[model samples]
Target: MNSMQNYLADTVKSIPPSGIRRFFDLVTQTKGVISLGVGEPDFVTPWHIREACFYALEKGYTMYTSNSGLLELREEIANYMKKKIGVEYSPQREILITIGVSEAVDLALRALLNPGDEVLVPEPSFVSYAPGTVLAYGKAVSVPTYFEDEYRLKPEVLEKYITPRSKILILAYPNNPTGGIMEKEDLEKLRDLIIKNDLIVISDEIYAELTYNGGHVSIASLPGMRDRTIVLNGFSKAYAMTGWRIGYACGHPDIIAAMTKIHQYTIMCAPIMSQMAAIEALRHGESEMRRMVDDYNNRRKIILSGFKEIGLDCFEPKGAFYAFPSIKISGMSSEEFCEKLLMEEKVAVVPGNAFGANGEGHIRCCYAASIKNIEIAIERMGNFLARHRKG
Candidate 1:
């Protein structure tokens, strides 16, 4: 018999736990540690949304949903996308609700990738894109983003990486860690490139609704892009329903059908009660989202300004709740900075290199934390840097 470890799938062996998980683990062990590491929202799921799920359970709607998702939920998601972001989706054949945006990302890679297919992923973004590509036996080509560019994907950088093997582009905007959003024209350049290059796009847009800037203009909303773009979004960031494990992928009918086929064998369906709750969240939870977005925007300003005053090159994060700040002034490696910040200051943030090779000299701090906590973390960071600054 093969050894216990060797029997695991090669893909399983290739991945690490997560960049942010280790910091939290250390925080758990340390006394008085306050974490700003994880990108999860600090707010609780709205009571009405939770009540809907509980009501479904009380009604015994606990069975497996349709493999794609509940029809009502899919319909609501379609309408929600249209009304909220101007992206029209057909409920019938365009949406497949998976676990979370994480699962949606995985399905997109698996359904489209043959081994060795290269996926160009914008860096210092979400942790999942490259790992999901790796799990699918595809190559995740990391295209680094610099502080000067505010971590937005440059079309020229993407063009430099396109090879015969390059088959997919993973675009994440209103991005994670960096809080960078590619506006309408930025997305258009990518769309033009994809059209000319015959490339498919997997857009992980879980942070869609959390934009401090007015409205989210989806890459999938751009002309000629929807047909080739698999848009990944979920109730996690926007609805504060991370634990619900509910998310959806929308694209052309053929891609949706293929993803549904894979999900059928893997998950069968998401939880019916969660589906019911998600349906309510989409249909009747507009005000809940609005309130949360406003709160997050207020907290965002506090965190960005705090980081700037502390003398970190805090990229003005436009979307999502995290700030990516350079730590070069301290002259410590990203890992060293995080380790020492946790050990000395009892504050936690993830090292940039943890996200990618280009993440050197930087760290990710989540402002999804409470304002008080962000203030405290920022103060601790300032003290730590002040004490460590070399002549």
Candidate 2:
């Protein structure tokens, strides 16, 4: 008989599973593991937001929302975007609620690609970008950014990767894994390049609310770029609502309409209760959001200082809750370092190679963990490093 595996599509079989999930699964089976592998916030979703969901259920709002999502939530999202980032979008035509930034990204890729297209992706980025590009029948061209440059994707680096086939540039400043942010001046350099290349952009700003230094900047707000940028954001990081699984895409109406068409057929809509809860999150949960960001900032300090004390070279993460530290002193590859550390000390952090090949020789430690856990993990890591250095 023919094998069932042989029946699967070649494209589906070719995609590799997420690298983060390997360490996570190991931690779940091991006892007393202190994990910094995942990027989820340690905080519970705010009570008032939960209460909004409960109230929606009480009012029997369990039916599917309109394929475009609740108008109320979209309006609130529009207002929030304007106040927070100085970007204006029409709630009716330019906003589409999605199943978190994950689906938003997928939809954007699907809407824009027409097979054999090229997407410029900055590395040491989140795991999904390259795979998502491939799934949408596009090629992902990796643009390397180094630790010496603080992991910022320079305009020159971006220019080298562009060709006639290049269609999109995926940007995730306040980036995952590295936690590096692009300043307005840094983005200004790209504005000319993007215009010169006639490229569209997919800007993932999921960590917008957690930025330090100056506030987060959306490239879509830059002059002459709004029509060519798709901004993907969600409530997962800022509102600690990962389980709610609601997000949105904002761009020109034509793109939004195209994304909405796919979302309608595939997702129908995001959960109705989540939409109701999101409205409350955008409208009344501002103070609570700020409180969480404040708490994360405090924990961020502890993690950065602790890494310094451990004698590891760590870049100061200006946004997001991750600390990417070099493990080159131990003479191990990023995967080897992470695996040995986990086995020796039961402290779990993802290897930098999980993000991209350019991330070798470093490890990603997520600080979206409790302060006590962060302290203990750091201590364990220090001990692990000491042993490895001696060996």
Q: Please report the candidate that would top lDDT against the real structure.
A: 2
RMSD of each: 1.6, 1.0
Whole-model lDDT per candidate: 0.87, 0.93
**In candidate 1, which residue ranges exceed 4 Å CA deviation?**
1-3
TM-scores for every predicted model: 0.96, 0.98
lDDT of 1 by residue, 1-391 (tens): 6479967898888888887888878888999888998778888999999999888989989787779888888988888788766778889899999998888888889999999999998887677788888989999998887778877788888899899899999888788778898888788877888899899988888888888877788888888888888888899988999999999998999999989899999889998988898988987888988898888889889988998899987778898888888899998999999999999999999999878888888899887888899899999999999998755
The total of clashing pairs for model 2 equals: 0
Error of 2 at 11 (Å): 1.6
Task: List, residue by residue over 1-391, the lDDT tens digit for candidate 2.
Answer: 7679989887778888898998999999989999999899999999999999999999999999888899999999999999988999999999999999999999999999999999999999999999999999999999999888888889988999999999999999899999999989899999999989999999999999889888999999899999999999999999999999999999999999999999988999999999999999998999999999999999999999999998999989999999999898899998888888888899999999999999888899999899999999999999988888734
RMSD, model 2, all Cα superposed?
1.0
Q: Find the 10 residues in a row with the least total lDDT in model 2.
A: 382-391
- Model 2 pairs in collision: none
